[model samples]
Target: AQSVAQPEDQVNVAEGNPLTVKCTYSVSGNPYLFWYVQYPNRGLQFLLKYITGDNLVKGSYGFEAEFNKSQTSFHLKKPSALVSDSALYFCAVSQRGTNAGKSTFGDGTTLTVKP
Candidate 1:
């Protein structure tokens, strides 16, 4: 079974400061990782993913993530955070080419960016 973890339940950041939402995974085989963001009353929106090549993967809305095989981590990052960036973030993982669209998701991390 594949499992993902977001160590922090809540992340508080200042507007314009660098922000990071940590994620780590455990899988039997090579993992396909994904990050998602959700706003109030809204469904999750894909943020980024790590499948093959380039450890640094960029995604929508100035967000990026680094896949560290050695650490088994795929933490989400943004150089500068905006107040609008405040949202719930999720980290997910699944065995490559096995689960298809199915994945194990983290409990979620609430990001709050204050002015």
Candidate 2:
């Protein structure tokens, strides 16, 4: 079985500061990792993904993540935080040969950026 864990319930950051949302995962084989963001009353939007190659993957809205195979972790990072960037973040994973549409998502972490 494949699953993801987000240890933090909420992350608070000041505007212009760096922000990070942690995530860890387990899968039967090589994993397909992804990050998504959701705004109030909106659908989930794709942020970035790590399919293969390049441990460091960049995504929408100036966000990026590092894929660590040994640690089985994929942590989302942003160089500078913005109030607009505050939203619900999710980490998900699926096995290489499984249905991509069926990826397991974490509980989700809410990011709050203060002015």
Best by lDDT: 2
Residue pairs whose backbone atoms clash in candidate 2:
none
Off by over 4 Å in 1: none
Clashes of each: 0, 0
Predicted model with the maximum TM-score: 2
Q: Pairing residues by index, what is the TM-score of model 2?
A: 0.98
lDDT for 44 (candidate 2): 96
The lDDT per prediction is 0.94, 0.97
The sequence of per-residue lDDT tens digits that candidate 2 reaches over residues 67-92 is: 99999999999999999999999999
Clashing pairs in 1: none
